[model samples]
Target chain A: MKNVFIFTSMLLISLNSYAAPPTFEILIKDHLFYPDELIIPANTKVKLLVKNQDATPEEFESYELNREKVIPGNTQAIIFIGPLSPGVYPFFGEFFPKTAQGKIIAEEEGK
Target chain B: MLLNSVILVLREVLEAAMVVSLFMAFTTVSQQSRYFLLKAIFLGLVAGGFYAYFLPEISNWLEGIGQEITNTMIHLGIFLLLTGFLWLISSNIVLPNRLVKAVMMGAIILAISRESAEIMLYISGFRSDHFLMQSVLSGSLIGLGIGVSCGIFLYHLMIALKPAAATKFICVLVVIVGGSMMSQATQFLIQADWLTSTEPVWDSSHIISEHSLPGQLLYALMAYEATPTWSQIVVYLTSLALMILVIISARFLQGQPKYD
Candidate 1:
């Protein structure tokens, strides 16, 4: 009975860990991305929760990521990025490109 | 800021303008009332306003994939309607004028709604900013002017051509335009993870950067992409092939004109 309980707990924990992708929160205020540089684990799909606090609409666009999303003012959007190789992927707010710039650096685990 | 507004608005406006131009030429050739186009434009604007207003809620749908899903639907809807219109024209079925017009108008409405919703959101975003409002509005007007002028120019050019020539030109243009819509829809699906993505077949940014004016115009007219994935190319080619088949069948098959 003690062995079964321990195994069951370990299985559940592992399942939970494998089930969800890492999530990163980004804030868009005054047409700029907070934490202009984001680092994430390489070769893993991740979710970006982008909250736009401004009163205007902005489009999160990246040529490298091939992602484009329009996030309205005071709204949040979820963008899923790739299980990519280690590299830097730059992104920007298409509507306000001058100010809203950022990059995501994917690094190998434990490095 | 002014330049960005102009380019952004121009990009959206040119897309809708191109479609409208084709329909305008068609209506004139068919001697339909101009009021029909006006009514469609008005309805599209109203619908777009509603779409923009409900955007936040819409964005939250489909497990946070709402925006992509909705955009994909809109793009696909336009492509299908355009295809239907082409089928009607090519099938030797003399459908009622109303039916043909309805299909064309449906495509127009969807196209305009998608473009206008983005424009409305963009313009509204600047409404509260007093300092930038003047520049943005001015830029928008300039973009709108240029876009409409281009449409008018295209319409007149089509009408000025020989009737047979015009029809052929229009058919080819329709095929390309519909293919563009299909490619765009595929991109949205890829973004939503509904379609698989692969590495781009080629990179053309060095030849014609997407940021350039000619590139933007080509994008609006032909769905040009700097780095289109393999899936995108396949879908685009398939759309083109389908359209060519329709055109060839219409010209050669020449079945009995059912309506006549």
Candidate 2:
């Protein structure tokens, strides 16, 4: 029974292991998000790679998308967002909310 | 504008200050021991700076799971320390006094390192030459001042309570705080897809969202989740129950002449 449990756990873990989702990168410079606008495909789970190029950290946050994480100065972080109907997802750098802002435009394929 | 900034920083720093202050009273209530604490805090601050600097680089390891792993490890470390201290106190072990002090001190320092990193990140955002920078500085100072004052108040209040009562209060508070760390660690693991989480148990955000001031305060004090997943709920309840049991046992230990 214990052997079965261990095998099942390993199998489940492997299934979720690092399948590289469609990825997009957004850079943080001078406390502002570069390309302030990002476009992604709708109805598919995707990874959003945020690289903070500034000498300070910035927290990438979005209430609409319900995601938040801090990227330290000169560091990069990843956030994953889901399969959904086409829509706009707005995100901002929490540390410098006044300036660091952006949006994700998820649209139909080939649109 | 300044007031808002102050409040924001205060909300962020409050948890760290309270954890440190709790230890201040717990380890040794003597006035002179404060300098000893100051030394530990200074060391923690320096370590926090290093953490902020290297956080990004560290996150780059382990196939992008490094960030989650590092954060979860720190939180787990803190949770274990507090739990161990509680166990020692309850087990009626006339352990070396230095052991208790060391655990409390290490817990406070580690907690400060993680919490202060956020504040450092926030402050780094406003280093511009504009006038806004000046106000932010003042606001951050005020926020820090207020947060520290609250921690001091809690410490004094803890000391004023009857011995048993103080023990109960601190035990409950620390356990909740430690459980929060566990919850947060679970969250990072889930985010990294290392752990499976069931559906969110409830959504009380309409009544009081985690984004609000009071909500944030509760989050810092206790891992108050407006929308907690089933796993988080399970972990919290289990941890809380165990701590209560430990506290009861510790109370029994207190009656022995060895404790006095």
Candidate 3:
């Protein structure tokens, strides 16, 4: 019984060690994007907040990640990114692509 | 750039086609048919020009009202116009059978007017020394040509088919096109700061970029955007609601007594 209890405790500890969430933020202003490049851990869940400070509406989208959302002017929106593999993911503003663009760099955590 | 321009022109042409088809299907009269269509196309171009010329000025002037107001109103206007279009489509008055010529003319006028096409021209990066006049004339001519061609085709098709069946098909087509336009207009309002919201309800930022071809097409046709503000949501919902109500009432009235 003692050995079994020790084994169960070790399993629980190991699971908890690998399960931390990542947090990030983005801002949209003057039809442009701030922090045009974003880096995060691969295969880890991430919470992203996008704030639009411009007078016009902007869209935050990424074909690689398969996500799209509208960020209204003077507002903020929250989004989640996947348990994705490590790589470079690009994003941009839908209305003004030439001027508004960004990327996400997914890398292995603690590597 | 060429392909993009073609696509844009085609999309606008399709819209013009819808308007023309609805008009042609409704009328069997031959008197002044071509004249009516031409006038409609002319008016649409003028309206488009007006919008293009004045939107920026209006937007800039509205700076003091706050972005929220500007966004909401723009969105609201688009929403209202789309809803009005939808209402026209769904009502029992039978689009092709009712004032088809008049509606076509109205839509064309709206399309080419300084308010609509002009804004599109500017946004698409077309500029001239005689900015307003040139834009209006160009947009009107384009819309007119499309409207005339579509009108001619639909008129012939109706002549070949039974009136009852033709009317039904035209009604369905109008609803589809009008609904799509409403969606697109709603998106435009949101992007223009005519609809202000607190936050985007869903953020798919990690996935697709909404500015791509598919995204832009959706934006132009159905007004779908990756991010939408609170005021945009409100305008979309309210406009949809109003459209539905108006359609239902119009249909009911059509079914009731006619003075004539």
Candidate 4:
């Protein structure tokens, strides 16, 4: 009976973590992406908080993800991405394509 | 992926080319107007380059509504300017050549800048780190060739048609484009939480996927969406009707003779 109680609590803790999808942040400053590479857990829906610190609008575009959103300057936007397979997905700002670039790297859990 | 680059760029270039050709055909391709058109295209390219460079700062301004609002404004501004030009032409009052040329120049600049900006972003995003260089280059070239040819085709076709028929066709096309433009504007406003969204009326993705070639073309030309909300439909139809009414009124006014 005591053992069962301990196992139940352990399972509940693990489940609780999965209940909330991990959040990753990306920032755009001076026409470049900060922390340009982000590693995220694969096969889980994730929330990306993209904050633009510049004074112009930049379109966050990713062909692999087939997602596009416009983030106006000095503001933040939320993007829900992936229950995705493990891989590298590249993205860029349309307004400053040359300077604004980044990637989302997805890997299997606990690897 | 390469196909997408080709298609996307083709769409923008074709649109810019179509507008340029339309204005040229309207003016009977005069030497001076051609020079002005070229200048507009050049200026638009420069503007697009600048837009791309400043996007980092500009995109982040105005409390994150900057991108949506700016885009909405650009499209609306184009619609308004076109409305003025259409009215002037239909009025049949001999407007000054310089004024007409200026309007045409403005139109060309907007058309080119919008398209060129799209192309630049697309090309930059799909940099060679991942895809095969040959495939991307060839696909883009093919798309460019097709788009340029299509523009040429439209110019000749417009030139061959009777002026009245041409006017009607252009008016109809403009109205359709304006409808979609307004629809997009409303969408951005909705995204910014300035407007409410109605329930989606229907989903057409089962019939035609947006990623498909025909779908992409339709999306570019008409702003066709597989899933459309009731609000979008309402806005689209209303704008279309409004544009049509304006054109009809202009034509009716054109037919009235002036007695000195």
Candidate 5:
């Protein structure tokens, strides 16, 4: 029974270590984006929090990243991006693309 | 969402309400029968919807007029709107009792025209979302309904209170609000590069993005921009200052004391 319990514990630890999640935060304000560029680990799941500070509505979209979502003014939205390989992903305010534009930099965290 | 929606609705409703109330009041007292007032409202609404539907065509034609001409037209439209609003206030005329039906008709027409302009902007691909179009239309309709009901209630209530003061106050409020809208429209045209060349005065993206709620509200209400190009600043300031001067002159000429 003791041996079996140790094996089970080791398996659980391995799974937890392998499944750790990465996170990122983005801010939307005044028809502009902050931290306009971001980098993250390859094949890793990323939690993106987009906080919209504008009084008008805006849509956060990235064709390369395959992400599109509406972030109403004075609200926040979360999106998952990832398992993406190393590349520079461009994103923008689909509504006011001319004024609201930005990019995301995704890279391998480590070998 | 509700609060923001309500604010939007209220702004639109107030304008509609004013129009309806003016119509009702005028018809009750004017030599023209009540039928004329109803016809005027119907005509105004239909014209507004028609303008909205044809905004794409209208904008194309306007664009063909050249950038300078379009800019001039926008500026002129804003100026006339501001002037009419100011005159209404300074003259201390109760909109319903003293405003001619033709003036009310004109005001409604202008409101509809503004709505149509927005539709034009959207259809031109200047604005991406169709949702905004629906929001504007629904909000305006709702506002109109509310405003009309409120105006009727107030008109009756005023009969018991100081009607003259109420009328004067309402007129001033309308002028102030309408004049502010004109200022915003003027600034937008200038920023869109429709007007004269000017440098970017400064950029504030480093501090806060204008996509946020506060930024948008300021932009919508006052044409506030964090990163205003030089030309945009010039146009904004010039138009604002001119509007103020015009309002003052109008008040003085009409023998109405300035509010400030």
Candidate 6:
């Protein structure tokens, strides 16, 4: 019974770890990304929590990252990106492309 | 600011316009009353406005994956309805008017809802920027004019062809458009982590940048991706094959004398 309990506990722990991904937050104010440039570990999937502070909606679009979502005013959006190779991926707001621009840099671990 | 608005609005409006034109061509070829198509356009625009209005709450749904899921559903809805429409026509059976109208409306509504929602959202952004409002509104008007003109041009071109040829042409366009929807749906699934992402099968961005005007038009018409992943390609081709299969099978089932 003790061995069974240990085995079940180990399985649950492994599943929990796999289920939760690392999360990063980005703020959209005045139609621009707060961290205009962000660096993340290469080849690891991550979540982006984007909060829009402006009184209007902005679409978070990245052709390189293959992600697009509309973050309505005063609301937030969650976007998942990468398991990508080491490189730079550029993104911009579709609504305010000129002012809202950013990039993500993926690098190898310990670099 | 004006040019930006033109491009942005143009891209969305062009897509909606293309689908609407295709349906218009289909109805013209069949000699069906166009009231259904016109009704669909009006209904689609209204529903789209509502969709944009509720977007905030919608975005927060399903653990913040709501947008992806909703768009995916819309994409798939279009694909399925289009398939049904193609199947009914390809069989050469006397199509039920009500059934045809339902499929047409359903597909148009889904497509417009998705595209117009984006346009409405973008336009809503300029509400607070009073200085940019004039340029944005004017640019949007120009974009709307161009997109609608192109749609009209396409519809007239299709009608100018012989009836049989026109039907064949519309069939080909339907397959391509349906394939695009399937490809886009796969992309949404990948973004939502419902499907695994893979390296792109090829990079054609060097040949045709997706940001360019020509690229935008092609993408709007066919969902052209300069760099497409293996999964996206697979889904696209599978959709094309499925659409073709329906046409072929229906012909076989009806034992049509010969291909058009």
Residue-wise C-alpha lDDT for candidate 2, range B1-260, written one tens digit per residue: 47756876787678878778777765443233556567678777887787776776777777666767877887888888888778766665423456666777777778878777767756766676458778878998999999999898989888787655666577677888888888877766766657653445676878887778788788778767776767777777777776677767776767642332
Off by over 4 Å in 6: A1-13, B94-96, B257-260
Candidate 2's docking class is acceptable
- What are the candidates' individual DockQ scores? 0.47, 0.32, 0.04, 0.06, 0.02, 0.72
Candidate 4 — what's its lDDT? 0.69
Clashing pairs in 1: none
Cα RMSD of predicted structure 3:
12.7
The 10-residue segment of model 6 chain B with minimum total lDDT is B91-100
Give the per-residue lDDT of model 6 (tens digit) for B72-177.
Answer: 9999999999999888777775334677778988999988998888888888888877899889999989989998999999999999998888888988998998
- lDDT string for model 4 (B105-209, tens) is 787787677667756654554454355446656767778888888778887887687766765566566666677677767666655445554434675767876
Scored against the true structure, residue B259 in model 5 reaches a CA lDDT of 31
| Model 2 lDDT, full chain set | 0.74
What's the candidate order when arranged by decreasing DockQ? 6, 1, 2, 4, 3, 5
True contacts kept of 4: 0.02
Model 3 per-residue lDDT tens digits across residues B65-108: 22223334433443344445545545533333335445555554
Q: To one decimal place, how large is model 5's interface RMSD in Å?
A: 15.3
lDDT of candidate 5 over A21-47, digit per residue (tens): 565888888778988877777656666
Model 5 whole-model lDDT (C-alpha atoms): 0.53
Docking quality class, candidate 1: acceptable
Off by over 4 Å in 1: A1-20, A41-43, A85-87, A106-111, B92-96, B250-253, B256-260
TM-scores for candidates 1 onward, in order: 0.88, 0.81, 0.48, 0.68, 0.44, 0.95
Summarize candidate 1's per-residue lDDT along B1-260 as a digit string, tens digits: 88888888888999889888987876676556767778888888887898889989999998788888888888888878777777777675422467777777788888898889988888888887888988888988988988999999999999887755665677678888899998888888877767765656787878987768888889899888888888899999998898788766775677732322
Displacement of the residue B183 alpha carbon in candidate 3, Å? 3.2
lDDT of 3 by residue, A16-111 (tens): 675534669888876677889988888776767778787555557665554555454566665566556788878887545667899989899788
TM-score of chain B of 1: 0.93
What docking class should model 5 receive? incorrect
Residue-level lDDT tens digits of model 2 in A1-111: 999999999988887574557888999998888889888888777788888898766788765454667787777888777554588878887777778889998899977
Superposition TM-score, candidate 4 onto the true structure = 0.68
After best superposition, candidate 1 residue B9: deviation in angstroms?
A: 0.3
Residue-level lDDT for B118 in candidate 4: 59
Off by over 4 Å in 5: A1-111, B1-44, B62-75, B92-101, B116-172, B175-179, B191-193, B197-199, B202-210, B229-260
